[model samples]
Target: MPHPPKELYTIADASERWGVTTDIIEDYLRSGKLQASVHLPRKMMHKYTRQPTECSFSDEVDVFDVDSCDPYSYMPQQGVFNLCYEDVNWDEAGKATLEKGGLYLSRPDDEEKCYYGFDEDFVLSRDKVYVSISELTRFEGEYGTTPRTEQQDCPEKVVKVSQDANPELHPKEKESLLKIVIAIAIGFYEFDPAKKKSPIANKITNLVYDLGLSIDVDTVRKWLKEAAEIVPRKKHKITPELLSDFGIPPHAKDD
Candidate 1:
């Protein structure tokens, strides 16, 4: 006879069954993606014992009962995986409503306030939400890329120098530079240009090449420097991996 499936699966079992890594399973449990019920023991006193000098005493206390409690019951219902808005305006409204300490309602303009309540069977759908064009434009203006109106005019002198500078340099270097120039014109220099000449640069250049663009190191560097000047600096401190890509040794001290 075939063996029956077990009632409870451990963390490893869940990971294998879901085709996800063990770390992912742990993350799901932590984020409450998967529901789990835990059985705790409830203590009970069996009987009473009597001693001549001490009078009555407790006898047996080994009895226990299974207490079922859902560990993920306390997870927030408004998490990213649980809730979604139809459009940017609705999303903004939802956020505003949440901030104002009100229940989320699908109809924002209805005369009769209708609210959607959370339930045990509630699950978030992965569909993309629709938003107003004006709201989308506003969102893009605030958080997305602005229109690139500036045209990159590579100086004839610089182009000539790049062409004549070094024949021995890798062909990938040239392609990398061109991409840097384009990125500079559009303003995207969050990384050091020298680092782009390294393996990481090679990878990015390859991606750009696949998109049908040629690149090189010098070209990439120039544009990267320009972009860096135009873009705001990030608040996070740079890591050693980032520094090392720019031909700088891992242990090198920063000036």
Candidate 2:
């Protein structure tokens, strides 16, 4: 089915764009770290089918009873559910709506496919409640990526420092940091790009924040190569691993 042209994204798109794993995204949803919305059935909106007039289904539901408590919106899709492992909208209009404190809902496309635009006018009523993780999202807060102009009284404080201006790291310090980066990047075990997407670059970026140092992923990778210059060399490392998740090549060969 065709989707609406509204400002909405799916879980996969959200993960790739936000630089976060779907697992982390799901965790945020489960914990309510991310605000989300679910899709309502069209049957609820129609008064004719409000009653359990059907005799086929084992479990018959009074449409009015369901609508009384949680009146899901039937805008996006008819009977199809609206959900995502992780999703978000960073468009200007989306931000504007959020700034004014309005939430957007993805409407069902004319073609019947998911991934359409958000409905700004439709707001959940006082009694509408989400029962499950219909769709995990980073629609608000940190993951929401609110712009500085729209930030709170005290906006996020951070001093930008370019790693290019910094002096080269000593071998030991570089190696230690590299080890930490690799450990975190590989999620322990061994470093392989083929099996999974290595977040090495992102990990290094995070470490720089933690250590208050100016370090780039290239610098860290260079340090790794420098550290690898040993008598017997370290041990097994990369071999046709899939670092493509990080936008690298599959079976990434040694540089």
Candidate 3:
């Protein structure tokens, strides 16, 4: 058997050698089908070296002969869905089981399932895949064992706001303020203290001052109360009176 070539080529070299355009190489990179490393220029080599050396190098150089999988290429005719595998239906579970080593999609069935797969391959339902980080954390709390990272712990400052000794706002306002505090604590956004010229802004400024946050209370309050709504609480434990009110007959509780 003849020995394979040991010399590695830059993307430019490979492009010239293969008679392909640089765009093709870039496509391969974006698709994650190819791996490349960058090469830096050395002053000594640029000034002192006499013999013609390969000058053009890529910030990203491709590494050949490694096993690479393109999620798009093997993706079923579905979309990319992020979900816990355990939640999928039996048929989908079977398909995922088959593609356990690599990315794969579940087979479609009558039951509801989240559609997800790389590129065209999908799990086969209009189910939403991506979720906000906060939701993922909540899921972790409910499931006990989360497949993803939990929401980061709140800072002491926010904790203090939640435990305000003298809350100078309504329940809804306080709730909004708490959310804003959390947003600020998580470094998502900041309140501008100088922009508190409106009545709503003034209210927020008062709340911020009360909470000991040196932020423009008005701005913070505006963001906190903006689009705020009360979420309806869920009823899990039903009383006998509630059941009777629903017309389920008194004997049904015993059964």
After superposition, candidate 1 runs with Cα above 4 Å error: 44-255
Local lDDT at 133 for model 2: 24
**Can you write out model 3's per-residue Cα lDDT over 1-255, one digit (the tens) per residue?**
998643444445444443557566445434534433222222111001112234465334432221224233232232222333333343533332212222322222315332222322233231222223333234336645323112233356577777796566897787766544433322222222233243444555666678987676646555544422221123113444433434445455454
Whole-model lDDT, model 1: 0.38
Local lDDT at 179 for model 3:
48
- As a whole number from 0 to 100, the lDDT of residue 182 in candidate 1 is 33
**lDDT scores in order:** 0.38, 0.41, 0.37
lDDT string for model 1 (1-255, tens) is 998645455556554544557666445444544432222122111111122242243343222211125343222333111122322122323221222212222322335322323332222221222222333234346644332221123366577688788456475775565444434323222344333343434455676789998888555445555444433344123455544434344454433
| RMSD (CA, Å), each prediction | 26.9, 23.1, 28.4
Per-residue lDDT of candidate 2, residues 43-134 (tens digit): 22311113445656636543322223334433224433333323332343332222111222333333422232333333333122232222
Point out the higher-scoring one by TM-score: 1 or 2.
Answer: 2
Off by over 4 Å in 3: 1-76, 81-104, 107-138, 144-153, 158-163, 166-255
Which ten residues in a row are the worst by lDDT in model 3?
41-50
